[model samples]
Target chain A: MAAFYSFMAVLALVFIAAIGAGSAGMYTLFGVAIPYVALLVFLAGFIYRIVYWAKSPVPFSIATTGGQQKSLPWIKNSPWDNPYTVTGTVIRMILEVVTFRSLFRNTKIDLRVDNVKVVYGSAKFLWLFALIFHMAFFTILIRHMRLFLDPVPACIQKIEFLDSILQVGIPTLYQTDLLILVGLTFLLLRRIVDVKVNYISLAQDYFPLFLLLGIAISGIYMRYFIKADVISIKELTMGLLSFKPALPEKALETTFFVHLFLVSCLLAYFPFSKLMHLAGVFLSPTRNLPNNTRRQHYTNPWNDPAIKPHSYAAYEDDFREKMIEAGLPVEKEA
Target chain B: MYHAKYIIPALLVFLAVVTFPFWAKGKAVYRVELKLPANQTECIEDTETMRTSHMQILDHWRDKVVREGERVYTNAKGVKYSMSLTNTCMSCHSDKEKFCDKCHNSVGVAPYCWNCHLTTPKGGK
Candidate 1:
């Protein structure tokens, strides 16, 4: 996996350089062809992983239960924490997925006042940051949908307008971009600054953060410095979408190539990376499986019929002679 | 207590796996191409009131030129100009056409650019 990752990283760097040099032919392959190929690979790899996991034998109910387990009404039970019924499980899953309840409940230990301090507090900042990062990234992606569509969607326009409502300057600064950048930086720093995290960190951990930072830096450069030829870029994009390869004269700019190149690298690297989690998260049985197995039975698909029965009657019949010899009591004794 | 030793290594492995994607890099390039007709197009009408078309404006701008006092800037309208040029070629054959298109369409391209923008910004429109 590391070898795979390293190889991908090298290729991404080459593409980055290619963009910086302002070559449109290479840019087209990177921007259009690679993205398409990556999408297909991503889908195939994603489906394979899901199917493989789904086919794995679970043998027993190993669902991680934290809420209240179902019990008799007369007895007190914890429903939210150890849900035993289907309804409880559904509610628990929702809270886990949407609210990140586990992360919200997280606690950190701090030794203060010469080790005498003992305080229990909620460590929900991680959850908040994660939510902010994901939400902002999602909003930014949706905002970019205008580029792909001929007549931009109303919702996208509204979102774009709302994102730049602060009206920082000409062309309007998108709040989500700033948020994502800040969030990414903070998250990366968190990994580096904390002693335990740093101790556990590998080159892989630093790579994504670095790659994202590279993307952000390039984007900022394009917006403020390079001033990419968006019109020509759009023409090429639309042409590609229409399956017509009409190369426009003087349509592309150096900065546009860089942006296109970075995006392509991201696409190609997606399937083989942790980024695949976007699809993997949905296929996770732990999250997707309903918790009503106690009420509903799931037959074991691996059962065979070679084993002999050892029922009480059979045992008695087989051991009757031995019992008579040893003078032990038996129901079928003469 | 027995699970503690293995847990540290397990956590380390998980973290490592999670970070692998960032390390992978791929090759990509940004290529730009300029497509022009085999024969050059120019706009050169001899009237004082001659106007150039939007297409001619692009031809002028493509070469990257600037003149005294008057300046043209990129704007949303400029984007429209670029798009329109993709379909029509005659919108930029002369001074009157270029000026009229710039004024009426709300975007402007250069007139002096026919010297280089096209092999023939002289005839056609």
Candidate 2:
């Protein structure tokens, strides 16, 4: 069902691109206007969501830990997993951001070979795929800077050169392209073949994967098969950047339109969907906060204060005679 | 109160953000205009093809000539010309500064082709 919905979504995008570009001949509108709209939605929605999250108060140091906590001086602390200090928390965040430490710590229980006892073991494929996928995507984005930046920056040029150093064919092949394809394939297959994953996976989950796969496939097709004119694409890109969007004639094909439209869809969907995890990961209290509940006190500012005793002046007023009778220390005589 | 405090401000912000596209559309009054090459009755390739794939063609020509020592280019129309930028292209379009630089500068591209090719007389800007 999930696959069906995702397939329909992809088909819808392709149909829209075909109809818009083929029948109506509005390549400029689809290429330029849609991207602009998507980017706007992405930025606005991201900021709005981040602001909303920031406005929500977190009164507890409820950082998740998979290991031991910091307690007595002699006790060992899992610094990265159960960060007690700000530095430890930052390190944990770095590990989480860079290596996905928590996912690396993922474990699953399965039946032993003897079939009598269950065994707990590591499940690392998803983590590995996710890490590689993110890294490859980031690299690909940076490498595309060559299109947007004329007399492209030295770093970007070097990255581009390094990416296609193998140069098996006419225009060199990038390793990231292969890696992303594999990563996305692994992710999709896991969702389809694994019963547990397939059972839990909604169409929402499959939609992004299928959509991303479509984007990647279309992009790969453009780079490898048709070989869209780079200069004209650059001109169009520069036009977009410089705020004067005129379509370069015959440079953008249906494949390019499909790639661009799908990317636009992803960008538009990013903020409103579960894909906000790209930003949400940072704001997560479980990941970002320090786990120092033993040393620090936390109070919920939203909760009301309890009833209290009378003021010192009032106490003095009420107990003045009693104090006079007892000759105890008193603030005032009433 | 809700209308004034919450809804109005949110609406104003959204309105402000969405206005950028209109502003961008409005402000681009002076776009890049390329001057046509002089003295050439027709180009090697069609106008559309040249507009799009000139960079790829030039790059291919550069590599083929420099690496393989091939110096002839046969266009789709079956006309042959020597693969020399200074001799062939500049022979017809003598004014690079006026023709090419207009489009390049408009798009913020600064190609290093002028570094090797003599665009101006020696020691002149």
Candidate 3:
């Protein structure tokens, strides 16, 4: 049901773009204004979300340690997994961010053949597909700079060369294009096919996946099938980048508008959705904080300096006469 | 925020990276101007089709000539021409640097046909 709704939502966006750009010929709205608005929202919302997370106080050293912590000199410790120092913690965070170390360690529970025992199995496919999706998406984003940058950078040119090195078709199909589709398909399938995952999947989870698939498919269709005028598209993009905001002399295909509109939707939806994980990962207390609670004091952020600690001896001294009258044992004579 | 020292710098870096193109191309307006073939009012196909699918048409010609051993192509108007980029396409649009490379370079598309084919037409036509 969640997947169906998300699919319909993406289809509705495609229709909106098609009608707006194709039928009504609102090129300025779809091509220029919406993208600019989406970009602004993305930037502002992203920073706001990050700052909101930053404002929340983490009152404890809550790093989720996976191995032996720093202790006796003779005992070996897993510094990467159970970091006790700032340097070790930094390395751990780097590994976590770059390689998705936590996802790499994901496991699945399975029943034994006899149905008498539970077994833990390595579930690496999710990690692999997620990594592929992210890497391909990032490379595609970088490649798109070709449209926006004037006198395109050498590095961007080199990346485009490497991407289409296979040179399969007339315009030379990109490898990342194929990889992104494959990754998204697998991820979507896993959510639908896996009963356990499907049970937990919400509309928001499926919405982004469908929205991204819509963007990727529309982009691929425009590039390979429709062969939208690249020069004109670049003209429009460059115009927007420079704030000149002029449509090209040549009319762009509706597919281009669909692609642009979906991308705009993605940007606008990013910060408010689960996609904020892009920034939230950096702020995760479990992954970012050092596991040094045993060696150093961690003062709670919510602690009030005005509050004084009362001693048990003082409490007993105050209650001695009352305790004697009630026939309760006193710590000292009244 | 307790870690404003780290978070603020990271946010700034993110902003810079995301808006790289805006700052990188400061005050420079870029547009590709191809030198259309002189004295030629019509191409084999309409201007729109050629602008979009010229590479595809060229690739098709390449495969037909090299793989199928067919050289002649008949257009919609019944005009017969050799299926050769050097002998045919570059004949009128002769200045490869000015006509072809202008748009290609602007768009960052480095078509590898020039690696094997001569940039100038054969025998300097």
Candidate 4:
């Protein structure tokens, strides 16, 4: 039901963009104003969320250690898994962010041998799909800089070259374009097919996937099938970047509007949604902090300086008369 | 903000990266203006179709000529032309720099057609 609703929501967005921008010819609304507004909201909301998380004090060295701790000179420790120093923690974070190390280590339990034996098996498919999706998405994002940047940079050109190295189609089929679709399909399928994952999934989980798939499909449709005017599209994007927005003289393909509108929706919905994981991954305590609780003392941020601890002797001194009246044992004679 | 020292710098870097185009091309606006051939009034196809799908047509022509051994291309108006990039297409769009390279360079599209076919100069052969 959640997936159904999310799919409908994405469909509704496509229709809205198709009608509002394509049919109505509200070029300014979809082409210029919405993009700016979405960008503003994305940046502001992103900063707000990051600051909110940053302000909340993590008072413990609660790194999720998967290996031996840094102790006893003779004992070996897995520095990458259970980091004890700042340098080791940094390396661990790089691995977590770049490779999704934790997700790569993900496992699934299964019942076997007439349900008498339990087996743990590596679930690497999710990791592989997720990596493919993220890497392709990142490359595509960078590839889009060509549209935004006037006199496109050589590095971006090189990326574009590498992406279209296959040269299979007329416009040069980008490998990432296909990979992104495959990744999204596998990810959405995992959520739907896996009963455990499906049971735990919410509208949020399905919504972004659908939204992204919508964006990717629309973009691919525009590029491959519709063959949107790349020159005019670049002009519009460049205009937006320069804060001097203008609709192209020729009407753009409806798919272009749908793609842009979906992108705008993603940007606007990003900070508030699970998509904030892009930033949250960097600040995750388990991945970012060092596993050096034994080596270093941690001061709880919630501790109050005014709340002094009462010694056992002081406590007894205060309750001596009460203890004697109650005929309870006293440390000193009264 | 417990680790303002690290978090603040990281946020700044993110902002810089996202907004690179704004500063990188500060106050500069460029529009690609292709120099159309003076003598030719019409291309093989209409302007809109050519703008969007010229590459597709060229690819189709290439496949038809090389794979199927068919070299003649008949357009919508029943005008037959040789399926030759150099002798037909470049015969009119001779100035590769002004006509093709303007938008291509601006959009950073490096078409490999020139890698094999010799580019025609400004004047027709």
Top lDDT model:
3
Model 2 stretches astray by more than 4 angstroms: A113-116, A249-251, A305-334, B1-125
If both were scored by TM-score, which would come out higher, candidate 1 or candidate 4? Answer: 4
lDDT of 2 at A216: 86
Off by over 4 Å in 3: A113-116, A308-334, B26-28, B122-125
Candidate 4 lDDT by residue in tens digits, A1-334: 9999999999999999999987798889999999999999999999999999999998787899989989999999999999999999999988988998899989998889999899999999999999999999999999988887877889999999999999988899999999999999999999999998999999999999999999999999988888888888987887888788888887888889899999999999999999999999999988888888887887777779898889978888999999899998988876
Per-residue alpha-carbon lDDT of candidate 2 for residues A1-334, written as tens digits (9 for 90 to 100): 9888888988899889878876778887898999999988987887677667766777666799867989888998899889889899889988899998888877877888789798999999989999988898888887776666554567876777677777655446789999999999999998999888899999889999889889888888887777765566766776787777878864468877888899899999988888988767777889987888878876664556775547888878888998989988887655
Clashing pairs in 3: none
Model 2, docking class: incorrect
RMSD of 1: 12.8
Model 3 DockQ reads 0.69
TM-score per candidate, chains pooled: 0.62, 0.72, 0.94, 0.94
Deviation (Å) of A173 in candidate 2:
0.7
Name the weakest run of 10 consecutive residues (lDDT summed) in model 1 chain B.
B21-30
Sliding window of 10 residues with minimal summed lDDT for model 2 chain A: A300-309
Question: Top model by DockQ, which number?
Answer: 3
Per residue, candidate 1 scores C-alpha lDDT tens digits across B10-115 of 4456445433322321112123233323454432322221221333344444434343323333443342223222123434432433333333221111123334
Better of 1 and 3 by DockQ: 3
Error of 4 at A316 (Å): 7.6
Candidate 1 vs candidate 3: the TM-score winner is 3
| Each candidate: chain B TM-score | 0.21, 0.70, 0.90, 0.88
Residue-level lDDT tens digits of model 3 in A3-54: 9999999999999999999999999999999999999999999999999999
Q: lDDT of each model, Cα atoms only?
A: 0.55, 0.76, 0.90, 0.90
Candidate 1 wrong stretches, greater than 4 Å:
A1-15, A19-25, A74-91, A110-121, A292-302, A305-334, B1-125
